[model samples]
Target: MNENLTIIWEKCLTFMRDNLNAAEDNTDLKKLENSFDLLFDNVQPVSLNNNNLTLLVPSDFYKEYIEDNYLSLLSAALKKNIGKGVKLWYSVMENKPAGQEKPITMNMKGKSVATPKMQETLPPSFSANVINPFVVPGMKKIHIDSNLKADFSFDNYVEGECNKFASTVAKSIAKRPGATAFNPLFLYGGYGVGKTHLGHAVGLEVKHAYPEKVVLYLSSEKFIQQFVSAAKAHKQTEFANFYQMVDVLIIDDIQFLSGKKSTQDSFFHIFDYLHQNGKQIILTSDKAPVDILDIQDRIVSRFKWGLSAEIKSPDFDTRRKIIVDKLSRDGIVLTEDMLDYLASEVKTNVRELIGVINSVIAYSTIYKSDLSLELLKETISKIAANQKKVINIPYIQDVVCEYFGIEREQLLSKTRKREIALPRQLAMYFAKEFTNATFNKIGEEMGGKDHSTVMYACDTIKDVSKIDKEIKKYVKELTEKIKQ
Candidate 1:
């Protein structure tokens, strides 16, 4: 057994030597040896599985310490010599030994002194004390709540032309929690557009992968609230210490911090500390950092230092996918036409989109209503339409001109021409249908045409749109653009 122990120790040492770049000086080697000796004295080997070493310690304290202090070194050593894809498991043993020695002690001089027997058995090169920079001393381990959903991972995030860039950057930052590429990832988008969800998801991923890593997920408002609480309790230093030590910091709804100068100052210091220390910082807001009102220039510049991504409103296909995913999860089925109509009308936000689906499900459950397109439109109109703004006429006109390969003046001009008149009449028809405007008002906006002419154009376009596939496609595209 002693011979086997010696061989294992030699192998571990050899692995360490091959991986680490600790100074070859005698002083550094002695320190590393001492750390290993102290670690081994406290840790015991468990059963091996699949070529992985499972070392069991006596307490959570040792488990965390070993992970923080030496896990990287061990992993590096194993991967360098044993090849890639090596894994190590460090678990805490539940039962204590009958007569375990006292835990290793650090003297007033900052030297780690082992027990007498341990000192005798420990190698000469393993007697000195060495400081490990990676180990965070006196960190209070936080337990994660298991009730949080796991499906909010990067895998489930749907990428579209609108949000593909943002999604990719978010995944990269989550996978590698540090200032590798995007130091402080800034994501901004409209409400109910998944900005907060993505921020929290990144925090969950980092925390799950590296349990020892201290990740704090809080809204900017909550952060301010905590800061204020700490100030009132005269625990300002304690609060500062708590934030300064975190490994990954995620702040959601950062736009709330825009006008609060004092809060921004405190946050500036916290941001600087974590960023300077190579830690990861992620932020989400409704607008880009520059557009956020009253934010200090320094803070704004720091926010823009990393990558910026925006989550635009989802397209038709993406919205339909979201509805289908939600309905499937709830075990509710709907006809194809009904699904298409919901996706078409509830095109504003994800929250509203899902709310429409839920209302339909509720109506079916309570009223025994058959799920049909007309029924969906009625139920969805009651809830979803109230939440939606009747899209403005000028907005439609601008969107139509932008969509079609033409200028606003060209569309409004009275040429009776086929190319321009067709688009101009379609815009007038949509404006009258979508807005609470009379034909006179609509005609005036369309370059002051007569109300009769507006009525004739509207009538002509309605008939033409039904038969003209090209006109129908352009109108649909223009409607979608304005809704977004």
Candidate 2:
């Protein structure tokens, strides 16, 4: 029976290779097979009856992983080779022969750690033993609530020049906690620039790469709140001790810690303990430590102990890519012109950019409007709060000519044609409205008209806009265009 089972297992492996190789595009299947080789390959097939088979694995973790992730693939491969309707099952091997070696175990860091064959149940509290928590009688081990969000991972983080350096440092800290010079990664940036996202990503990555390592992520506000609660309950020492046990502690919005002298003193001690123990720390703040006001000098000094990386406001190209990425995720398509329009208009922070895109998508859905340039302009005009820029006479002239479908030279020419006359007058009016250029300066720039002509043009447009809806619409559209 053992020999037959071995033969069937070899055939199953061959079947897996053939099927998986044929579907090379199925990367998830390929990853499952890779995990199989890393985990299930060493398992011994103990029984086989025609299409029914059973294999013995070393630990519950291995059994659970195989059952959850690869059982379907393994069964499919076995059926392809053995016969239709073949079934497979796994059982834990509780006993081992003398002199047999224990199965190798890989930790979250992907490093092999030697574990004894026999398993033991541990309490909830953490301990000094890095590999295994030291057993304590009567006192339970601490349970660390990491408070990290799973969705905020490094994989989904969009990397660009504005945050590449900070992302790199975050990834390094994730790989080897407290091993690099960046023992504590201090990330400072404007709100919505992805500092909180990056902080969460670092914690999640560290937890993934080192499952045994304790990770805790909390906002500075929450930290202060917790400290206050603990102090009120007279459990401050317990609070401090619990934090000291975490391998990686992520605190967001450290700027809020200002003016909280007691919280600062408590955190200073926790920071010192964790740093001295070679644990990793991550902090997010709106400003750098030196610029943080009302904070103790010693606390600020500790913040400056590690590398400080800043995430600046994304540039035009980066913002463009961000909008494209967002639209792609929502399966929405926009023309290059529309994308450029959005990227140009929303040049603030990432949060606001995403908010603007969401607003546009929502408006399109509710209004049942196709994503035309006109719809885009109207939506932007409605939603963009910070889209204003300093205006100039040249910009006004350009908008006027573009709106009337004429040339700058024609608008500025001596022609008295109604088409040219109206747009030229509108340009002079906007030049007076939007720019600091005096009437003389505006007239001198526009076909060398007299200052009185500029004044008369402004009055004519303003009066017509009051009673003429067509003129009002034109003025509104031109105003929105110029602002955008």
Candidate 3:
């Protein structure tokens, strides 16, 4: 009977998918395909009792999504596979904690079964209203828009060895907020590797679990601007009070606060106030606290007080999964060979991988071209070319090593001599300046050093260049050479 359930569900899914494919949808193809995938991945057939069929779903969100978008199509498929009089029902399982949302699914032997709400208007993944980060007009309560993006939920965040530790820490903070030791969680990583995503995800989850909590998220630049405005009007106390009053505060790109004396000082006091009050603070940065430039020692110490998680670049296996999953959601299909090629070539970060995929999809859909290996290769090369002549890690290393008159072997070696060490540091610094590779990746190319080592190298070069005229001039010369 259980096997029959799986078999029947498989047939129904196929029927529904085929029908959806044939339907004339003025809606975006990606949205249509995404909706189909949402259901295929999330819903499973439980048991048939005479004239009724029950499907297992993860939450009421799934139930509402299916009934709202695909209820009729599902009804037709059920009629085709089960019986004309059969009705569809849902058994919504318990709401799992945020970031731990792997729904238990049966092996129907088809595409893993499920539910997609409408593509564009899908509700926030959390159950509660996202805390507005502003005061609502004419309302007794203050509501501020939190600016947490809906798509950055844990459901969409791909976890792997590179990001598992950080992802886990973010999840823990989400569950307990400031109750955990990871208060003022500091997340640092290169561009688009999900430091910002995890920051917003944590804020969203905290809002979801504790609706009464005043959760707010803003960029460091935004914070700075607000502070400048406050300073202009002599409202610094109001600014500090506004932030300190929040239960959970998330700030992205904290590295931007570098060298801004007034802003950093204000934030220092606000951070201290929040931490002393047991309020949770989340921050994202491009560099680790120890290597972060121009911030006060006290503020840097506070950044290190909580847990700091480093999100490295995703590896080949993780990259491959990202290509498949992201392309699938966007309604683009690639062959195994194509997927393998992409996973290997676009190895820098997730954001770059996504950009490449989007370009391919756009070209394919517009020109009606096949997603050939040649097309994929050509697309990747063009994108690579567009990345500023691909001033990449190896090229930067070659430039720095040759300019310093050091052998490539020594530059990439464990030698700590100043001649070799400074040039190696230059290579690491230039790789960061010239390429999109993450600190972890830059470290990898520069002989298995960790991200902190990469950060330290960059920091050392920047600090030395400031006071040492010779070093400063040499850095300028190398910068021009790298661009050329």
Per model, how many backbone clashes are there? Answer: 0, 5, 15
Q: TM-score of each candidate?
A: 0.52, 0.52, 0.57
Best-to-worst order by lDDT is 3, 2, 1
Per-residue lDDT of 1-484 in model 2, one digit per residue for the tens? 4776678788887776677667778876765555456575667777766655667777544554554456676778776767787656554444343576743332221322332333223223323332111223235654666888886788767777788768867876777787654757899866688998898998888878789998888889888988887788766676676776789989899988888998887888778778877899999986667656678988777776667888876878889888888888877889999999999887657887888999988987888877998889988887645555557775677667767988666877888999899999889888888888999888866856889999999999999999999989989999898876
Candidate 1 residue lDDT tens string, 37-153: 665677664534465655656644455345444667766655654457645655444323347653332211122232221111212232222321122434455332322246766
Model 1 residue 205 CA deviation (Å) reads: 1.6
Name the best candidate (by TM-score). Answer: 3
RMSD of each: 20.6, 20.3, 15.4
Q: At residue 78, what lDDT does model 3 achieve?
A: 78
- Global lDDT of each model? 0.68, 0.75, 0.75
Worst 10 residues of 1 by lDDT: 114-123
lDDT of 3 by residue, 1-484 (tens): 4998899888988887777677665453334555578556977777788776777886543554465457777778877877787766656564333465544332211222332211112112312222222443235565567788978888788877778768867887787787655767999866678898898888888888898888888899989888887788766665666676688889999989988999988888778777766799999986667656567888888886677888877889989888888888988888999999989886657888888888888888898988899988988788778876567776677678668887556776788998899889888988888778999878866766889999999999999999999889889999997776
Candidate 1 yields a Cα-based lDDT of 0.68
**Top-lDDT candidate index:** 3
Pairs of colliding residues, candidate 2: 108-209, 124-141, 125-141, 125-142, 126-142
The better-scoring model by TM-score among 2 and 3 is: 3
Off by over 4 Å in 3: 1-141, 385-387, 390-484
| TM accuracy, model 1 | 0.52
